[model samples]
Target: METGIVIGAGIMGTALARHFLKCGHRIALIDPDEAARAAAAAQIGPSEEFITAPTPEALPAAWGPCHFVIEAVPERLELKRQVLGALSRQFGPDTLIASNTSGLRAADLARDMTHPERFAIAHFFNPADLIPAVELVPAPATSPQTMDLWEALLTRSGKKVARLRADLPGFVANRLQHAMARECFHLLEAGVIDAEGLDTLTRYALGVRLALIGPILQRDLNGIDTHHAIARYLYPDLAANTTPAQVLDDKCAAGMLGRKTAQGFYTWDARQERRAQRVEALLPAVIALARQIETEENDDAEMGEQARGL
Candidate 1:
């Protein structure tokens, strides 16, 4: 029912566009490269509504009553600001603007926009369409209406959105993700465990439980006093530095970017990358399992309440 404009035409952008199209919204995909557009088409399929171009300047004149725009360009603070400025000029003040930045603070990205209140961070996880979780970060300058509208819109699109309390660096998920990564790299560098050992233990041990009960609930089940005691004893050994881990920095310097370059902590090739894509397909099942678990818990609580009343 709405016309949505998504700028970038990369993996995230195309995924978003595909979702929008499935929801019966017309989409205009903007990207500067023809090859990028072609690749996107290959992923999402060709459609008249899938308008592609260098910029918003090339948006179809018929894309009327466009209420939402998601800028999904690469993670560069300056580049995002520039693109946002251009979007503000094109769409006027009323149109809702969102950035799919993974780490940049919403306020910093909206600093240059003419109407800062219209901007927010709609940080979709990788493979936006497949990932149900989206971190909704709003700057203090962002309007309350913008927040409400986006929460409703994304929810209607079958997204599980977490509206963060503060628009700090890295948001919520990324901070936790990097916190884990930093420690893993530190341990790897210290020769405490090999990469495969770390990965194997992580998959079979931490990953399975985490997929169901969250860390906070796990702490509650384990007892707070026990957790506090462990934290007191273990905090000193954890990686708590601001600097990038030397192991990670040196790997990037060597251009051993995993999956794409076929080298990193583990070797990768085209076949490996293709196999990894299968992992993404399992997310729907995981989401369903989480939902069912919560529903069963809720039902049990309700039955207990009824029995107590009787």
Candidate 2:
């Protein structure tokens, strides 16, 4: 069994560790904080295949080098550098040292490595275990051998990997996500769309279709002529500001930081857990239905071609 060592026992780290464990790998989860390790342990539970340690120093001295090492530290640049640097020191050149960073440039994290060509950014989405997508980003110096090894490993672990050639800001999903969010907030503040109205409209009207057909394909389905007309008229008026949204900033200043604070745009105190569970249960089925729709569309087109040939 390939050995997988994950540093930091935060939510993201713990989820990745659990994923590897489920994949039948020997997993070593290390975190400096005992409380964090304890929390992760409680969440993941005891397993003979899993090794838990408060710190790398606290691991059994006999522990050999691992096949894979991933640093799942905080988003702060310096902290990730320090943790990943230490991992590089522990493992040798053949081991692929990776960071579970969502938005950081691969160069920034790879800077601390002795062999920068071995460093990579494997960005897992929130609720890592449930999400199928992972952005596997390679630094400019990263080698083909490293990419090949990770591509095979992550695919075996059940990830729908998107190997990004360029490490652009926000990658793909996040860029489109934030862009749409920018417009959402703009409309909200202008009184064009209320919070609840916007949520319901997006979830039912746009979200359902997006799940069935991705944005570009959907554009083709609707005819690019229509897209051209909309873009010509609306592009200039869309939000282009790089600054933070005033409404969210004001809400944060007022201490309404969502579920943690029990309120933000909506009150989460009473409904948060129940709503989260519902969404979690519904997502898999949504993905399944999306796939079924795609298959049916393909089958119908094939039948049309057969009839025309006959």
C-alpha TM-scores of all predictions: 0.93, 0.91
Screening candidate 1 with a backbone cut-off below 3 angstroms (N, C-alpha, C), the clashing residue pairs are: none
lDDT of 2 by residue, 1-310 (tens): 7888899899899999999898989888998788999989888999988888977777786666688888898889999887877777767888888888878888887777788788888888867877878888888889988988888899999887899999776778888999999999999989997999999999998998887779999898999999999999999999987987899899989999876688888888557768977998887787678678867989999999999995
Worst 10 residues of 2 by lDDT: 56-65
lDDT at residue 109 of model 1 (Cα atoms)? 90
lDDT for each residue of candidate 1 in 1-310, tens digit (9 for 90 to 100)? 7788899998799999998888778888889999998888788887766677777777657656678999999889999999998888878888899999989998889887888898889999877877778999999899888999999999998888899878899999999999999999889988999998998899899998887888999999999999999999899989887999998789899999787688987788777677787788787787788778878999999999999995
Query: Candidate 1 versus the native: TM-score?
Result: 0.93
> Which ten-residue region of model 1 has the weakest summed lDDT?
56-65
The candidate that wins on TM-score is: 1
Over the full model, what C-alpha lDDT does candidate 2 score relative to the true structure?
0.86
